[model samples]
Target: MKKVLAILLAACMVVALFACGGKTDPTPSADPTPTAATTPGGEEKPTPGPTTDGVPLGKILEGDHAGREKYKIVYMCNTLAWAWNAAIADTLGKLGEPLNYEFTAWAANNDFDAYLNNIPAFANQGYQGFVLGIDDTLAQASMEACLEAGVSFVAESTTIMDKDGLCIWSSVQQAQVKNGGIAVQWLYDHWKDYWTDATLDGQKVGLIGLNYSAVSGINERKPGVEQKFAELFPDGKFFDGDLAALGTTGFSAEGGNQLSTQIYSQNPDIEKWFVVAYVDDWAIGATRAAEQQNITDKTLVVSIQADAFLAEMSNNYTGNVYVAACAVSSTEFAIDMANYLVATISGVATPETIWPEWNDAGGSYPRIQVEGTMITRDTYKDYLAKQAAMLP
Candidate 1:
């Protein structure tokens, strides 16, 4: 009996061992909860924070590491109140913060003396850079002052003369002469039928110029037109006889109106009147003159610089008034100049140059040439759409 009892005790021990082993190795629970690994103190290890392309947000948010310094530049225009002023200002502001620079603008409002006088004021006020859209007659003096003051200056819209290394101007637009050629071409192409008769070949075309007293660009456009007309129609004579009527007035709508009336009265039978002025203010005055004289159908009106009146003329002035404008991307050019000036001040070796070559395209200068868009009654809508897309 003792031996049998001992056997039973051994069997019971084996069964208890099997039961403990089964409990230890049982299948994982159907709804198991995952427990993260922890440190010796029972604190969970931190998961790596989210990253941008493997770079941590904290690191990416840091400021520019290139160590570029900020610069201050001053831009001077013929006038700040002009429509193009807003464009230049907008571009400069857009380029300022990104490139770490500032652009301050000063305007002379088409006053040659005022422009010349403002140079010292800007220099005294800590302006180190300048972009000049100055009167041509005064450009020599203005540029000399800029160089004397040690201010790095760039010229836009207007050309400046220098003796090789002494003067530098980065022209943003094609020469005013080229723009004048464009106007002349448009007139020849569209109005050739009007002057088709034998007597009209040598007929005179009058020019009404604004601020010819000081502004060279204004004067330059007149000659450009004459030269281009001579090239296209060698027999056509400009500013002679009935066509020789040329007048100058202030740069204002009222001035344009007053001048237009005088021109109409002086030469009523003048076949064509080319107003070398901005499309809106001057064109408006010309339209008013045509309306008052009841000669809207007989005269051909052309203008430069597209504006609200030009847009309206594109749609309405089909037979009466013809408009041609030299369209410029002033905003984009301003932005580019701002960037270049900042880069230059920051020690970038790149030099800025004019858009169109002063001579033939042999030399090296960074120039961006923008062409004017021609608008007629048929294409007014298309022009409007394009103009709208450029906004903002």
Candidate 2:
């Protein structure tokens, strides 16, 4: 009861699971990159192409909603090719059955233009509400369109300009950021066990980010990693510290593999790697690249957005290279969003009442933050059990 927003968003809450600590650099050490990694058996590695086909979007959701309350809702997914987006879209598609809302989902295919185009199309079709997994580039347009159409919309995991009618819901940005730092700490905690070295002064690290284009939610995570690195090893360095080239086409396994290969070729001495991708594909790609370079044992790989499938893969992977991952369950997040949407449509909640940031008197937007689960090989089973227990 601390605030109206907290009371309304009881289901869409954020829970911080860990804190970060740091140690100063005791000695001025040399650069971390000691040597470059070579391809297996000293063979030349193939040059990676621009596109590595990522996971296909799962089957589309279709069924008869013959007798439902006929609340046509369109859920605009960020991209269907990514597993997380697909999971969310698919979950919302099915929610219409029990939730009494007609659902239709469309994939933006990671295209900003396409994302923009989808908005008016849905509005023209007379869709009542939109559940948008927003991209930073085009949120204002979408919000304006929804406003003009007199349609209610909520943003999932991303925000648009603060407007009166819109509500933004996401897992806590710090949750993702903290996981970034946690990945770094994972290596530090286990560094002695792997290297038998007393200190971790000159270890080079590699990073693969979704993109460097100032996407609000994703960009903050890189600093979280950097902050942790600086804390643990004062002046600890990344491969090149070049922010511009650190991004990828999309968070795909192909992009991950290609980027990892590129990083391996460019800075083979990187002893550890941190990846904050759009999805789990980057983790899979990096691990594959590490194995091919025959440096799986030497490198520590940590990532975020490990979906259920990839978490299972973490259990099966041979070594600890796929170190730690945070699972932001897209399906669960979608469910919570659906509940909010249902409440809003039923006249039970409004932006000003539920979102702390929304000002009833000030005419502002609403924002909700949710929590995610972290998974390691050891903790995966527990996560699975908790998820299963939720099933009817």
Candidate 3:
């Protein structure tokens, strides 16, 4: 809440998760090369031409209450081939009905330069609005392109930050600080069932926060949990794992597995592992590695956005290894973002009136953040019931 926008998303790298944190550097430290990631589960995306190929540009999903002017918008993300982005696309597509707009789901494939390039590509092509799942390194340039074209933008998964690394503008992302802090507290409270404070303070357990240092959006997921952990266990030996080194698409389970495996192999003195992650794919991957190593007994992982894992959470990734997650409805997220983008573009809402209240916390931006629910194996049904209520 100090400086990053947190609201309205959870998926891609399973993108669309809550993004909170500052922009320390314009460029992320990871390699920008596009790699394959089969998560959130659907078909795979081709090297995103950022074109109309897999991207369903100008496609209109059937809807109701017509007679309104239709505008073109784009949901530019890492890839559409994966399930994470696909569900969001479907939800965005449906907004055409009562909201009255068409869209192109541009799969950018984690290419930073491509974001710079394609903003103009589609802007010149008459795309009037954009919902981006990207970092703020290029926020200035991206904003410039939109300004030139008279295009409106609403950020998802990633908040657009200012030159000062403070959040700026409107975004729909997760509650990074709130969720991170709460998850740590939950993990700590649950851990009390088996371990004592002296044992935790004794340095027998190690903490790992997995992230791609380059993707500032996903990195937001860590600070909340890390801050809470530091307060609880001052001597906690926390390891920050850079999944960028694994180099699979930004947030893949495979990348997480490789990173956690390395962490486990390298840290021999640690008796237990507690991992904090954002996307379900990465958490699932980390859980896979922990289970394979037979360390779930001592290791517990919690993550945000259960969309990717919900399909199979009951059958797999059960128990305390992957433990709990914060679930947000993709349908609900897209609806909120689509409405905000169109409303802002159409002048139906402004910076002053977009959010219901100004005192609401979401960094320093005009954010329409969606709250998430924490669910465990014991409360999966409750989440499902809650998820069902939001169905279109």
Best by lDDT: 3
Candidate 2, residues 1-392, lDDT tens digits: the string is 46977765663442211110011111110111111111212222232111112101111112243444667778776655556656666667666666667777776655777777768787788787788777756667777766677666777666564455433432112244554565666655665665565344455655544333345566656765677767876644554222335454534566667767777777756665554443456677777787898876666666656663354464576575676666655544555566556545555555444333322223444333333445667776666555433222
Q: Which lDDT value does model 3 have at 7? A: 33
The predicted structure with the larger lDDT, 1 or 2, is: 2
Stretches of model 2 off by over 4 angstroms after superposition: 1-68, 110-114, 124-126, 162-175, 190-199, 203-216, 240-251, 269-278, 308-315, 355-364
List ranges where model 3 is wrong by over 4 Å: 1-65, 81-84, 111-113, 165-168, 192-201, 314-319, 359-365
Q: What is every candidate's alpha-carbon RMSD to the true fold?
A: 29.9, 18.2, 14.2
Score every model by TM-score: 0.63, 0.70, 0.74
Deviation (Å) of 377 in candidate 1: 4.5
lDDT, model 3, position 208:
83
What lDDT, from 0 to 1, does candidate 2 have?
Answer: 0.53
Total residue pair clashes for candidate 3: 14
Compose the digit string of candidate 1's lDDT tens values, residues 25-106: 1110000111111221223334223222221111111235146655667777766544555456555655456556566666
Model 3 residue 332 CA deviation in Å: 3.5
lDDT (Cα, 0-100) at 308 in candidate 3 = 51
| Residue range 1-392, candidate 3, lDDT tens digits | 63333332223323442221101111101111111111111123342222211211112222332656788888877666545567677667666555677766776666778877888898888888888766666666676666676778877766666676555666666555565666777778787653444356447677888777766666776887788888887777888887877666545888888888889878879887888776677787888888888887778887766755565565664466877776655655665577667666666665445643321344444544444566777777766764444434
Model 1 root-mean-square deviation:
29.9
Clashing pairs in 1: 171-354, 204-243, 239-244, 240-244, 327-372, 355-367
Name the regions of candidate 1 deviating beyond 4 angstroms.
1-70, 94-100, 109-128, 148-150, 163-167, 192-213, 233-237, 240-249, 271-280, 308-319, 350-370, 377-392
lDDT of each: 0.51, 0.53, 0.63
